[model samples]
Target: MGQANNKTVLLPLAFALGLAGLAFLPAVHGNPKTFAAFLGVSAALSAWDALLFVSTRRGGRTLSVDVALKKQHYLQACVQGSLMAYWGYYWPPVYAFAPFILAQLVFAYAFDMLLVWSRRDVYTLGFAPFPVVVSINLFLWFKPDWFYLQFLIVALGLAAKELIRWNRDGRRTHIFNPSSFPLAVVSVFLLAAGKSDITWGQSIATTQFYPPNMYLVLFLLGMPGQFLFGVTTMTMSAVVSTYVFGRLYFAATGIYFFYDSYIPISVFLGMHLLFNDPATSPRTELGRIIYGSLYGLSAVWLYQLLGSAGMPTFYDKLLQVPLLNLSAKWIDRVAGQWFTLGRSLTARQRNLAYMSIWAVIFAGMSATQGVGDSHPGQWLPFWRQACEDGRAYACPYLADLETSFCDRGSGWACNEAGLLHIALSRSGEDLRRADPAGAAVPLRRGCELGFATACQNLNTLTSGTGSFARAQPTIEDLPIILRGSKGEIRERDPSALYALACHEGWPDTCGRSPLTANSLP
Candidate 1:
């Protein structure tokens, strides 16, 4: 009866395994379309497994171990690891996936071995592995080569586990166990070697064995070396800092949230530094400044919240009154309104009165400040008037002209107008028919105002050269233009294609050949 039941369970298990094998097809290079077909097959297999599981439960029969193990959830993880390996082998040109496979394996082995040794039942292990595996997978996805070192580190971790198990009686046999220390040392060496190999290997070969000159160069050029160094340094610092900070916070405020907040803040800062692509556009300089200011303010606020405060003077409290009182009032009012109204606006009349007062105050301020006169070529007003006068086509005409509004005070308008002129020039239209050399002025102004695309465009017309002939594009600048072009083209922007084509030689530019071909019109 047990054997017969096992065979019945094997049906779903077999189906899930087959689906997993099929799913590998999409991950293969030059066969991404096969992935869709495999996805459908996987979905079907998942449904079959679900039905089997439900039927078994309803009939008061537990799924056999083999059957339960063959579920799509487990199969999916195995397939995902295999997919990473396939990508590591085939798509090495785009990204390295080897570390991902390694990381997944390490996580699985660690969780399984740990749980099993603890004598925890299989079901008792629950879905904890899922989130742990997923988080590690995402970390690998972001930094795949990080996995190579992690594999070696896992051995040290395993040793640590054994040592902890042996010492569980709270008695130390020796300060340094001979068996433990060597394994730890070897693990550290392997981890370091793996990191160095990733970062400096390619660059050394390219530059002919010269060590990186600048600290930043290691990170920008050396992927593995920089990654390993950064990971080790940050991890060590974070562990030590957390311990110290925790002790201090506990002693002072008895708060643990401050420690919890540390990781999030550190991660945020790291991401901003690592991932926030710096803008090449001149207009973006203003944005960068604003972002910097906001970041500074946030840092101050976070410190104020987390740091021990010296008692404030009476004057200090007076200065803080506006921010504190306004925040308290806003919070109270919002909570009251939300609870009282549920969905409907119970205080509609009061709300309208408050809104009208704010609107009148804004209007009075704008009129007193003479802001309207400062914006003479108001595109919205012109469009609205033209539409009221039954000119349905005027909007498109203005868009074509790239003259949505006239505001000499507005840098954005000048930049857009410049782009419009450049597009007209590209379309083989003679701007000389209307403004002669005046067309170049907007293009030049736009470039000076920090519009990088405009700068490249104006360089083509005025400098009698393209961006390629000027100098090698910076690493930061290339990705910005490429990514922007990608987004713009995806949104059906015709002009972005030309920008993309011009940056074809950029190292990070993906699908450049197709873009270059498409841009030739």
Candidate 2:
């Protein structure tokens, strides 16, 4: 009976792991290296499970399926549905990946069911995995060739809720959040291994802005969760704190600190989705405020920290969640001890009050161009000027944005990027490998694309002639807005944006430096 129980427990996990691995063979069969990794993971899981079976002893354990309708999860499903409706409509990749998403749902439920059954006869299951899978997908996905990792990601999240448990009150609960735990773990491994290219980590961070009114969509879709879960305080504190910190950073530096919007759409999503898990977040109202505030401030700090390390900045939202989850109990305890958190109002009333304040602040952000569908910082031209103004961070970002435009067949963008590298050389900033010859690569591409000035500049450099004059960027020479997925998108929002810039009439206010300190910190 004892040995049989061990088999029951380990066998299902091994089975689930094997099936999940095999499911990816078709997706990865074209590449030998990727296929080898997939097979290796499968073999490792099998061998580990067999070893556990041989070495471990266990008495027969009773199991039962515990069924409870968690309103928080199902309601989150409704919210995710609304988010998917709009996001999927805008980026059809949402639809393209629908089958895999559906497969994972099956895998999560099956894996959770089997894993639970291994220890006990009763397994409580519902839509618990829905939000976990969807949230992780929104934040990160392995590119198509490496899509097999997606299965492991989903499985890890599901298993976290089952395996990593701690005592709370009279019962047990998972210490880390299901979705965040896996994402944070994977983020660290990727960062340490310096292997972020295999995943769409960067693209997901940027392309989240592809949908229209994404900020507004996030706000509206988040309302039900806020109202029902009484997490409004957490959301309010997070948003306000991030906004406050961003304003202060702006005060110190001429740059808009986030380098995009006052609050980037992806980070905004993190504020709402990543850290606001009701179960994982703090319990007391004051604790929730502390939790949210810390998340907001930490996100800002991590953005700077990650950038300086030359790693992906998308990890800013992810890295702090598990830490917060672990500290939640202590935060509540500290709040109860040190602060006067006596409540005169009911939890519902308190949540509504917080939501009302958030509404006003959000409106203010929208009106003042703090965040919206469009912003001055989103313009490539603004960053180009900043790059030329000798901002080290701006050069790499400018090169990236300009490369996107160049990929869309914009010869002028190619020329602009080449010139920016030349400018970088002059300023003694060597962010991009510090190579002066890097200028010729883009310049040659622009010349081939039939841009007369690019051809002239390339000829001037390669023909042993003296350096050519760097062309000054003007309205005519620049691509006004980055549009499509590849920066080929054309849209009319630029009209209103520029009209506002021209109206502000600040010195050089062609939407470049509209507000903030005139000097860097």
Candidate 3:
């Protein structure tokens, strides 16, 4: 009886942990709406689990097939519908999340049909959908807008299925039991609250969503609960047997990679793309891009190495132990030896190595035409002309001096040129030659490339010169402008805030405003 209870519990716990991993993916992509949806679904699922518990306890008997099937279908449909509604509310234009909902429903129906055709029991039919849901949730995390809704639907389905099993059986006795339900509930609330805070544009310092301190608090708070739960769920005899089995499994097989390599790389790429640009300074951009690329490449390389080695075998799964410690230690030893060898090179050899490195660097720069030409803002025809002529380096100085530098490939030059055009429009120097439409191209590109200063400059030019009269600030642009203002204000500057206030139709400066003052803090 004790062993049977253990099996039932471990299954749900494993499913819940997998769902928690799915919940984190939205936060990874910085999608507040999706993150919120993930939280909501988690909460709803947890509530469903509670409902199942009450039902089973009250009945004092295993759940009937009719009760379980109805609950599962209802939960799946409700979750799918809620996610669709969220997507429609937050991201209607993209219409990206619609397909995921349809796919899930179709897959669920197909699984049901297959079960019927094979003459399997309803419980077996329900279990068949678990792996499919897990795989879909894993795939959906790579997309920013699609992740939250997909995860919520799939996770809710899994939770409902597990609850049904527990309802039919008195108590779980698996490696991943439902005893961790309390922790799962806590995670749901934390994730949901974090997402809600982000959506309302609340400050992170005040919000627990991504705060460093909150993570520490959660870690400490959950440790005791985990320990107590583990103790109560499994007996000492079972624990000993499992430990021995785990050791044997570790000896027989190696570690498995359940998570995908591309997910992390995609996440890094998305973050770097969002944060990279001129606003951060060229030095910061260089460091960020290099570091991001290196991390992505390293992850991919490790995945390839692991896949070639055939890790995470049946023995590892049966024992429930990771098997990669030995390989990791061996790799570390080899790396240390290689680093020591590198440090032992003679001065003459180092000099030759440095020369070769410089040659390669120069060749790469020549091939890519340096940062000036390749940067998004530097793609103007004039800047390209200058870069092609080998005079692109002078563009920034020329822009600062308000002179039309002939360097066509310089981002600084394009920015200056655009500003000049805006200034000319205001001064009535070139009404016939002024290209207000053309001016937005460089300004927007510069803004997107992390030039918060450039965004501030563009805000000034557009709002001041009447170019932005008909345009409304996009939801995406509001956060960028707000971030830019905070950066400017930190430097004891108020220009970005002033622009934002003016854009919002404030008569006075940002700091002096009655309505806007509250937004600053």
Candidate 4:
């Protein structure tokens, strides 16, 4: 009995782990060395889980399919999210955040154990680890830097499962996809706060990382699971709609809706893995199509609207999924009513339905007022703070905004700007291509400031011998306009404009002059 139950959880987990490894392989440049920690941690956790399951089986325990499924999802979320954290950004802080991650998992496991213990026969976490894992993974993928926020999101998502339900005709159901709802809610909140970091896991998009072989490998691996979940239709529909609608929007407004290509690997993963959750999406064929179409449309619409409204694009799909998720009950009801016994919409009715959805999208997008960002004033303070704090991520955005000042003789500023570009050039084809010469402008300025390291780095970049960090900036890190140069260099700082590129902490600059350090810091 235990062996049977163990297969239930073990098979899916192994499959997911394999797929995740393949998917991240391209991004890691076929270098298994970088995945050392990721593999170690994942193996340890998975082994422990297997042992626990096997022990319970030895004690005459039998696992239900529901429990097995939950365990699979939970395992996937924890394992995949951790891998993404390590390989995605290769962010060192993941080690520091270990305690929090463990705490979150412990709490989730304890919560389920308590529920089962209290009501042995009646209580079962049917979706056991799915909701919890998804929430953790999403946070790890997007905002792992903000550990408190991750904990908050996990708590809120779990809490909502119990607290927020609609009771109708004595049949109660939660109105939101547990994992997606809190993400959507908090994403909006963070967007408003200028802290949302939605990049859609481009860190593992095989194509983006320069090697395409593993891309095919990952697609093939994930296809079986996607089909098994009956999500291929939804995933395909969302991808197609995103492309077509995105192109339409770009043509109409001269704005590139999605920075990456329409069908990047990340989109594939998200459409199948995140948005098309079997529990939240409609199960019916036609209903799934509508659900996916709505997702694509909502994603595109929100991308444009929120971007113009001064929020990040990270929340576009997050917001869209939950809103559509909330309508799952109604979608099923309508699908049932419409698809019953030889009932099919006529061509005209079908067109009308599509038109109505489009109309809503257009109206909603048009009606969204600008949030008083005529001068890009909203991000100015944020960028300035980030720059002052030596926040590396703020470098690219501020570099663009401060270019004119740099050109007009802010030597230190120009050097700093160059460093930002170098930082950004660490990842993404578009960004990498933008600085083919590799941060020559700012680095030269720093060199001119007598900063020896700046000279060395500038030499390294110019000679094309410099290497990038294991975790570097992606498309999300670039400012919208600076994504591609589109062939324009507005600034060539003249020698007349020279300032010391020195701050207290930059020891190389300190040797240049005490005044330089004082001035910049």
Ranking by TM-score: 2, 4, 3, 1
lDDT at residue 518 of model 2 (Cα atoms): 27
Error of 3 at 234 (Å): 19
For all predicted structures, in order, the TM-scores are: 0.24, 0.82, 0.24, 0.49
Using lDDT as the yardstick, the better of models 1 and 4 is 4
Q: How many clashes in each structure?
A: 7, 9, 30, 0
Clashing pairs in 4: none
Question: 65-174, model 3: which lDDT tens digit per residue?
Answer: 21134333333334334433433343342244444433343334332332232232123324335333422331122244544444444434444334333211245322
Q: What are the RMSDs of all candidates, in order?
A: 23.1, 6.6, 21.2, 16.0
Worst 10 residues of 1 by lDDT: 312-321
Best by lDDT: 2
Per-residue error at 142 for model 2, in Å? 1.8
lDDT for model 3 comes to 0.33
What is candidate 1's lDDT per residue for 12-93, written digit by digit as tens?
4453455445346324322444344334434544565566556655665643221134232353344334433332342343
- Model 3 off-target regions past 4 Å? 1-80, 112-480, 483-521
True-structure RMSD for candidate 3: 21.2
